[model samples]
Target chain A: MAKALLLNPTAFEAGLVAAARARALSPAQSAALEAFSKTGLPHRRIEAWKWTDIRANLRDDLSSASAANDVIAPSIFGGLGAFEITIMNGAAEWSGEAPAGVTISCTPQGGPLSELASNHPLANLAFLNTDETIAINVAEGASVEKPLLIRRIAGGGAIHQRVTVKVGACSKVTIIESFDGVGRYFSNSVTEFSIESGASVERLVLQNGSDDGVETALCAVAAETMSKFHQTALLLGARIVRIESRIALGGEDAQADLRSASMLCGMRHADVTSQIDHRAKGCTTRQLHKSALKDKADGVFQGKFLVARGAQKTDARMSVNALLLSDFAEARHKPELEIYADDVECAHGSTVGALDDAALFYIKSRGLDDAAARALLTEAFLGEAFDAMPHPAIERTFRTRIARWLEAGK
Target chain B: MLKIEDLHVAVGGHEILKGLSLEVPAGEVHAVMGPNGSGKSTLSFTLAGREDYEVTAGDVTLEGENLLQLAANERAAKGVFLSFQNPMEIPGVATMNFIRTALNAQRKTRGEEEVSAADFLKLIREKGKLVGLSDEKLKRPFNVGFSGGEKKRMEMLQLALFQPRFVIMDETDSGLDIDALKMVGEVVNSLRAPDRGFLVITHYQRLLDYIKPDRVHILAAGRIVKSGGPELAAELEKSGYDQFIKAA
Candidate 1:
């Protein structure tokens, strides 16, 4: 049993606790749920959760919701010939072969979630909720040509999924994680990534949410010696969507590149928060994030780069730019750097403003109407975020989505 | 032909062009020479229908079409082109793509078929060479990382590509080298036709040396105070705008 709760739990938390009690939860999972109930949902008073009051935004008590058969939609990246794995509403399924050097399966159970990741609130909720973990492994020294896609789908209810991926030494692989939901729902997902020495891994996320749907996608990635990790994401937010990337460079000469972009419309809300820890010598990290918001959409970016003691020659830089397209749109950014090592070079920057009127007029004078001019400038503003992305088809798809969003906004 | 009658424009609650009037007939190139604060840029912007430059009272007709009643882009579609004094550097917009898109937009608005990509590529290459711009420059982002002269060259490139009916060169000669200035002269001279007209706004007679204007008008304060033949440019270059400023 957990100690005396310092705060009163909400009805949602009570319902979740009751649901956990009714299920055959492992001791570790029961403990995780008890801890979660103690904290309930993150509130505005909490420093990290101040800007994003998940508890206040989540109005429904998502304890009892149907987790039965969900209608899965075809993936947007289907034509890319990717190895597809579908996790619909808490159940996992896959079609076709796994291809050479790649393995996919579902585990019977999981012991404990990542200890380092659980230090934050709402961290490992997926692990406590899901009965089994879907695993994907790339064999050693094998370069998988086709992309491995994990498409997670949710309906108008609470759904959770846990995924574990590992890229063996000297192997190269691309993994794309897509989150999509329908109607009002709470979709929670957690993915753990491991990249061994001399291996390279790329993870791309495309999160498209339905109206009034709430989603949270948390990723914990660890890079070993000489391992390279790249993560890119494009998010069109929903009612309230929070995407968190927690990357740790654990061995010497590791490299990590994390980038994301968000384009929100209507009254949608989105948050992209990341934490990168350079825990070893000669590690490098580069991060760039941008958000173009319209209507009454609210966007938030919180990034932090930590250089541990004795982590010399650690080179890291992060920048965030937010464009508020409408008067009612809001963007909040917090970029932090904590370096205990004197020999490290680290920098962070953030900018928020509207579209450049001069640029808009320049294009308009060239014969583009106001809408077309604005859309062109906005798309140009977002050009660099996707330059490093692999696969032209996926890149084109993301650009098409942005163009559609821009058209709808006008 | 471009016609303006008693054009009164205000920017940011302050009147800039107060009952100013001028005219450039078809097949003629007229230069509007004025010192700073004489509303040279305002005149061009107002004619092109920029939103910020509010026209409190005015009648600007381009070939008998009511330009004052149109939007900026609509005016462009009507073959009204104003080359800005200071062009903006739009990063991330590929130069070729933007030009092609703008050209297609205007064509679409006019209910014309869009030019094929291959045709556009050849056309842009030809214009790009005429403006002394390279293929590498065409591959870059629009005006991004370009010098002042290069930006003017870009303006000339569009001027050639669009082939507007009425052209307003707002200080297109300001930041150009000898070769670039000569290129501008060549481009304008090449595009000169009987059915088209030009309004060349500048503070110097050096550019006029390259492309001789049929008429020169001295704008003081907000209105043209003096109008004469080509010799007026050389005369004003020697006498300065002090005489016109005092008279207005």
Candidate 2:
């Protein structure tokens, strides 16, 4: 008998192969699967995924499944009257009148996965499985007053979504995404942001999923000259959730501000990992991440600032803070800087502690009970992460979500 | 309106307040004076229901209500307040919002109506002026970046705002200057009423010169070894706790 194949095929590998068999693959899709078959699911052994073991967490065989329950929940930011784009289980739908200077369309394919993220298994998976993509383009020199909300709600099964957002030169836009799901599902999403010169892009994300859900979001942003990319996210962690950001500054005086707050209770887990590359001179980046956890939950934050050889006068600061409300809660942070430039200013700080005893005593002395004191302290820590949210309505939603989580914890 | 009987408290398994006993009748400010290591802070913490200080044996009451059985917040709702020796600097908490929430919480706990925003702001502004604090200070995060004197003034501000029935001032005069001392006296003197009471714990007799006390008790080694009038503080300042520490 011919020697058996040395590699034993896993369930995910077999499923991925089956998915490829049922579809007519484009060249890029074929290349994406070819790259994924070699890498398969990312395990804890992978450096970038050491804290998030997607291989073990997503072990379900990806057979065909039905759509999610079509229960439409009112938007939390409904009062602001944001233009809503509902993407359910990879199928996109939007109705009603479109706001001025905002254009939305469905495209068969935008482009191939970025060369820098081609090695990422989840990125490859998103590329291989995404057949229809959504493109939201803000025209050059146009200003959109209202917010654009991409409310991605999914049901049970696997979902792969790819969205491309291009903010034209001298234009401004605010976009918010909510990753909310029901039962067990694996979602792989890739969002590309191309911010042109003199443009401003404010993006917010809220991730709240079912207890058995596994989700990963990859954000790749490119900022041109004098462009600004500001991102704020609040994650109420799923069974396994990873929100990763990869940004590259392309021209002079570009700025990027990224912030995230995560609250995890029970046995839930969350990882907010980001890598920002300063490839141009006179660029500035600021990142702040805060997490509050109770029970046996875990929160992870990994941030890296990379300045290339010619990227001088680059100033970047990063701070990661955590509040562990219970003894069993765990927080892990790895803030790093890889600088090859001669003149650059970069600083990072991290702290992980429980609520301050003195502050608790002070609050209680003023007639607040233990629950109120803890909730206030937790909010004080997590609230600052969303303070710079460009939209007031989005900030309010984040605050309400955090309050609900804290109440549930209590 | 406050009374304590044979209070025995332990800190880190060591008895700090051993068989302590004292009483502050309503409408009077009672001062408890002692030297270092006399468990003065422990007494205040235990009285305020700090969880770290275990009450092995004791009974504390406010207006005949069992304060010992209640949490710190419950004790406050029952009209007991403690001006800590060192007020905490809580960053990221809006000063006005925190005070408002605390006031409403106490009201809600007592089944009283919550204060409206305009009413609360009006009350806080009045009390803030009484404590020699400006509106700018009230707008900042609670006590963040405040000087020691400003922190004491903040305590006084809360004192005037809450107007609790029974108040404990633990060494409130330690970090104050002449003006701050007078300000504290003015705030406390204004809040003094027929139904209110004060328990002032201090090291020197300087504060007694301002907020006159009806009774002065010498607390040595966690027990009141002597009780007398305001002159008792003058005597302790002249001689020292050496006499009482040895007697206890």
Candidate 3:
């Protein structure tokens, strides 16, 4: 018998590995786990994990996963009349039946796993080790009137989950994903979206993790001809949070709109990264990100647009703006564009500054005290990201989140 | 209604307003004219309480109250308004919303009731017409995409709405055509009252031809070098401030 090796193994890691091994695993999956035992989890020493010290965050040694019976309170979106699905400790539970024209099932195969298995090590590990995948499919020409809500809750140990969504031709739907937790845990999630030709999908992601929890999410989307994909993400704060998006405009006349707003305070860290590829002609992509950092927090934003050859008439633009409220807070931004087509219109800009003195004075000269003036200005700054959202309910929810954060700061 | 006694100011270590003194009684319009590089703008901004414009000496008072002891917003609530020469264009702020908020804020500070939306709408419409600004202009972001003349018109509109007891017009007619200038004059003449005063700062005599100031003072090297009646404006316009500039 080969003895198990520990590489900076925390109690949490040991418990997660034991639970995963007890659940079933193929020979190849067992071999991959053995390989992971040798190298252990990646640390800040590695090039890609320099800013986020995952190994240090997992220093505690945990033994068992939190019980499944631990109930979570209602979500902030509870009043939106959405069809709610709860995933507790990586297990999906549907309280109500699926809406008409929509089907839900459990699929272990057939997803983005095959496409991304070899490119990214983390994706491969997550696909091979996760218990199951929840699949949602919409029939062709079907329109879903109500939004779908997916809530993920985790505690005590590490949990990885995946979601696959497919929208048929000419279909329309809206999906919202909320990540929340209260204990010391790590949640790694992946969501794959496929939009068929002439389909439209609007997606919103809300991440408000506990101070001790760490969350990382990856979203990969494929767009067909004349299809549209819009995504807006709002993150309050986390110990180490990262959200990555990779979108491919696979057909002509496809369009994508990506926007995000983040508020980081204390010692929290948040990163929003995106890469958009224009592979077809006459495709358009627009991206905007805004961050507000106070105290000793840190924010990171990196965006890139890649236009391939023969992709003429490609219109793309990206901008990132950040506001720093204290001397110790920091903001890092990088906007890149790699264009090979001669007739493309591509541009990127980034700015980091303190609040404007003139505007502050103007607002204060009204009757608002200094604090109220600051809150109002900060809201106006971040509110621009949700300008294009069609649903007023979701927009108002995001605005309320901003207001809550400001109140907590005070 | 407003008084400045030996107000000395400096910017970047250069003294701009050295021992400058002036007084505006209730219901009076005072014009300060001088050559280039005079300290007229400095006086207006300092009174409006802009940061970094150091007040090295003396004091400013309004209605026997020490204006120098208050912040910019406090002074504004005390009925002091400055119509900037070049108004700032805030990209995402709505013009109508900002105006209403500012008005309500001032009222709230003075223990007055908040203005209703219907009342605000009616007031803006009336004031917009008096200032020659169309309804479409009020729908845009605060001053965004507006020309210099249009920006001046916005200032006039704010003046008509706030109705402050003391108003400082800093080169309010810099880029206006004859029609716009006439409209500005009409707004000022309509707002005139026995309890309110106006300080119109200008570089030309044409605007003075419409508003008709009671006294025109020459500011040179941060201090007043000459004071005269309305004819003094035409004299300086024709002969220029060559004598005043040399004397300062």
Candidate 4:
């Protein structure tokens, strides 16, 4: 009998380790990486990874990293005049000088290294091997009028990246993270945000990956008293992609709203998993996820709300809706609510269905052919997820991406 | 003009309209009275090109063009409208938007220009008032959370809006009160033109009292068993469909 050998780490982990060593990672960071290396990449054996086999896709041992050849065009958010930071092949590049009231540094202290090492084994391995982390901090009581855009571009070999955002007390800020890449490379990323009391932060994450690339993003957010945290994510599917968001409401009256829309075509796969924990009383959380899957694509949404015993009067609601365009397309939804407080109100609902025939007939009767009618209805359905976004620019960008996806799919 | 010759329809392998036939020339109103399960609704659904109802052996034509050869929306574009007995409530579809889309689709299919947004808004508002639907009702999702009477009024509003060449009202009076019934009569009376025709299917004669029919027929076992003038409706109301149910 030939024994199966788990001979090599994924290309992403190897590249990340080389990048970290070149940056001369600290002893603590090195130790964290060593611990992460033991577990390696998550495979189909893991319950959460059963649907998307990231390990299978990451089997190749990547070569040494080089500068990606493709030039990244301006972001869809270019008209917003955002403060832009570009990361090419896991290295950070600033367009110009950093803006006032905001400090940007290269460090590994405040990101999701510990969280990744403790919770997700694969993310821990990526963090262990990754080099520098982009640290962004907003000054106390500072109001950022413009959005801070972080663009991550990867090509050829694998890459690992990390980002940390800290919003000081009473400050307001918005951050937009856009991930685009080429070639067959693996990209692993972790983003951690610490929102102080009375602070408000808005975040938008856009991931559009190549057919051969595998991407994973782990986001951990901690919110303080009276703080507000809102995040909207749009994903154009990859060979295999998973985005995990973990939000902890640590202060009274803190609120968190998370919304995501995903469009997947061909044989691509996309999964969005989120967990919201309420540790204090009077905290509220609202989550909505919408996905449109076509061809043989698969989309997954898993959301959980955990309210501690003393977190009384906690209100949390989650809804996940999916539209399957083709008969071969698949969608899986798991919404769970764990509430220990007797006074809390928690509810969750999930639905997966094809477009309504009656509605199609009605739309077609009005003037649209089958294709036009289907596209219009689909856009309207997914548009509901981003309808409540506070920033018009962010909402419009998301809408444009959705339209582009529909148009391209056609 | 619309014509049905030797129409035979079967649903779920069971025959409904067996050799039934009727004709309505332009500028005429024909009423069909039948007992429950006498295939009244099935006839309307078949005429509207619903998928489930099968025409085993029949022929229907509108202005000398084959109606069954066209798709449902195509039939709509060809000026065939059926005011459903139970109007479907589609969540997330705006009432005014759906109406405008359907109207423009019909117009576009017939090589006409699309209705501008401002023009559509004004037209719907005017027609909505004529059908007793307030502006607030039109702003809501299509028929969502609407009362029975309001849903019927919505159907009337569509009728007044589309003004299709051939209109089939299947049990439109089933759920309406006197006021709603009067509203339906007013819509039909307004849309009565030299080039338009109507087929009103009802169980009660009260509706005919509001909008007088040129001819009335009694349907039994999927076939027209008797035909007469306006007095037939009064006679059916006086004596019930008990005799036809036994004969059918």
Stretches of candidate 3 off by over 4 Å are: A1-19, A27-48, A62-74, A107-114, A121-125, A154-156, A340-343, A365-368, A407-410
Backbone collisions counted per model: 0, 0, 3, 6
Query: lDDT of candidate 2?
Result: 0.89
Q: Give the best candidate by TM-score.
A: 1
DockQ of 1: 0.84
lDDT of 2 by residue, A1-410 (tens): 11112165577666766777578878888877776776777889889899999988876675554556665467677787889998888899999866787789888877887644666679888877888889889999889998999988778788899999989999999998989877778888989888999999999898988788889999999889999999999998889999999999988999999999999998989999999999999999999999999999999999999999999999999999998988999999999999999999999999999888878988998999999999999898899997746677778888988888888762
Ten contiguous residues minimizing lDDT sum, candidate 3 chain A:
A109-118
> Which regions of candidate 1 deviate over 4 angstroms?
A1-7, A63-73
TM-score of each: 0.97, 0.97, 0.92, 0.91
Clashing pairs in 1: none
What TM-score does candidate 2 reach?
0.97
Once superposed on the true structure, which residue ranges of model 2 sit more than 4 Å away at CA?
Answer: A1-6
lDDT of 2 at B55: 92
Q: Work out candidate 2's RMSD over C-alphas.
A: 2.2
The local distance difference test score of each candidate is: 0.86, 0.89, 0.83, 0.84
Query: Candidate 4 residues A243-346, lDDT tens each?
Result: 88988898999999999988999988999998899999999998999999999998999899999999999999999999999999999998998888999999
Model 4 spans > 4 angstroms off: A1-23, A64-74, A96-100, A108-118, A365-368, A407-410, B12-14
Give the true-contact fraction for every prediction, in order: 0.83, 0.81, 0.31, 0.28
Clashes of 2: 0
On the 0 to 100 scale, the lDDT of residue B79 in model 1 is: 90
